[model samples]
Target: MRFLIDFFPIALFVLAYKMADIYTATAVLMAATIVQTGLIYARDRKLQTLHKVTLLLVLVFGALTLFLQDERFIKWKPTVLYASMAIALAAALWIWKKNFLQILLGSQLNLPAPVWARLTIAWIAYFLFMAGINAYVAAYYSTEDWVNFKLWGYVFPVVFIVGQGLYIARFIKDDDDAVEKKP
Candidate 1:
């Protein structure tokens, strides 16, 4: 359910692109993202930083893409977003001596400070990789190829998430183990 909310906009954008063109797809993405944001707020009553950032970027870049009739703006949005995320995470960790991943998910999982630090660094690296890859594809590839990459690039996140889950699993205490220890 949550994944659907997060993904439907991109899916619709691709569908719109297939049926019409990049301009139409941009409009559909803008509208779909707006709807996704509203649905999230309605469900949670508050928006996360990522949600707000995504919404703002979609609206701003989508407007530019449509208004200027340039597909490059839309193509570059993901690169900008990923770069910004990497920068923010790096600055927060190094300059501020804060771990945002810990702040965000610390309550849900119990892990050592070192583990959280490692996870934060991992996320920063992942963002940088994503940003670089997107920039490369957007710059060197045709619009058709970039669009195809957008659809197929879902593999990267899925793999990253699974890898992260595997890493975090070692730290998560099984409920049954806790219960057995309680005796």
Candidate 2:
């Protein structure tokens, strides 16, 4: 359910590209992203920073793609987004001595300060890697190849998320620990 809502735009974009062309796909992506963001806001009553960023980039890049009749803008959107995320996370962690990820998710998950710092660093690295990969593919590959990579490149995030969960699992206190501590 949640996954479908999150994936709605990308899925639609790929489908549109297959059925038509990059311009049509860009339009579909723009419309689908708007719809996806609306649904998220309706459910959560507010948008996450990520959701807002994604929406802005999609609209801006999609508009440029359509207006210029050039696909490079849409193709480079992911690289820009990922690189920006890496910079933001790194700045928050080192320059400001603040961990945005911990600030964002600390309430839901309790972990040591060190764990939070490490997680933040890991996220920064992941974002950089994603940015680099997207840039490489977009610059070096044909549009069709780049589009195929976009569809298949989803594996990276899925694996990274699962790996992150595994890394944090040991630090998270289970309900059983609380029950035992009560005695």
TM-score of 1: 0.97
- TM-score for all predictions? 0.97, 0.98
Query: Among all windows of ten consecutive residues in candidate 1, which has the lowest summed lDDT?
Result: 174-183
Compose the digit string of candidate 2's lDDT tens values, residues 1-183: 888898878888999999999999999999999999999999999999999999999999999999999999999999999999999999989999999999999999999999999999999999999999999999999999988898889899999999999999999989998999995
Estimate, for each residue in 1-183, the C-alpha lDDT of model 1 and write its tens digit: 998998899899999999999999999999999999999999999999999999999999999999999999999999999999999999999999999999999989899999999999999999999999999999999988898899999899989999999999998999899999985
Predict model 2's lDDT versus the native.
Answer: 0.95
lDDT of each: 0.95, 0.95
